[model samples]
Target: MNAPDDTLEFTGGLVARLPEPADFGIALAEGFARRIGDLSRRAGAPAAAARWAARAAFAA
Candidate 1:
């Protein structure tokens, strides 16, 4: 395993536009939830239906 380094290195010059952090986090969470639901449906287990139901509740 690689040891954790605490040094701050500015190697890459990447411009970030983070005006709305909340919106970004919400979008990220929504994407992750959708992916989980899709994977559950594909797996076709007993919990798959619950996953879809959760998606519907959160989406609406």
Candidate 2:
């Protein structure tokens, strides 16, 4: 997924194709977890999904 030019790229390879925290226009951690949770659920990425689930349990 191509991110906006203003956002930092995920070169670390922890979770790929995640939207930048700023994209959600909310708290950094919460936004990161929310986007990852949704993406992982759709992409069937179990590791990322698990992290998202644990970090953002309220969102799920």
Candidate 3:
């Protein structure tokens, strides 16, 4: 997936090292949110998905 200009890309090699489907899903979700956060910052929108990621971290 393409990361925003402000963010580093999530490399395929790194994703390949994930251990399981659930873990992969969470990582993918978080990574996507991080990219969104970068985009939001650029556009002056709210980082709502980053809040979701924060809640997810507390749930972990």
Off by over 4 Å in 3: 1-19, 46-60
> Pick by lDDT: which candidate is best?
3
Ordered list by lDDT, greatest first: 3, 2, 1
Q: lDDT tens string, model 2, 1-60?
A: 333343322223222345665334333434465566667677776875556463664244
CA error at residue 47 for candidate 1, angstroms: 7.7
Please give the ranking of all candidate structures by TM-score, highest first, separated by commas: 1, 3, 2
For residues 1-60, write the lDDT of model 1, one tens digit per residue: 111142112211111222454445444544455565666667774675846644664354
State the RMSD for candidate 2: 10.7
- Assess candidate 2 and give its TM-score to the true structure: 0.33
Query: Which numbered prediction scores highest in TM-score against the true structure?
Result: 1
| Global CA lDDT computed for model 1 | 0.44
Predicted structure 3, TM vs. truth: 0.41
Score candidate 2 by lDDT: 0.47
Under the 3 Å rule for N, CA and C atoms, how many clashes does model 3 have?
Answer: 0
TM-score of each: 0.44, 0.33, 0.41
Count the clashes in each prediction. Answer: 0, 0, 0
lDDT of 1 at 48: 50
Among all windows of ten consecutive residues in candidate 3, which has the lowest summed lDDT? 2-11
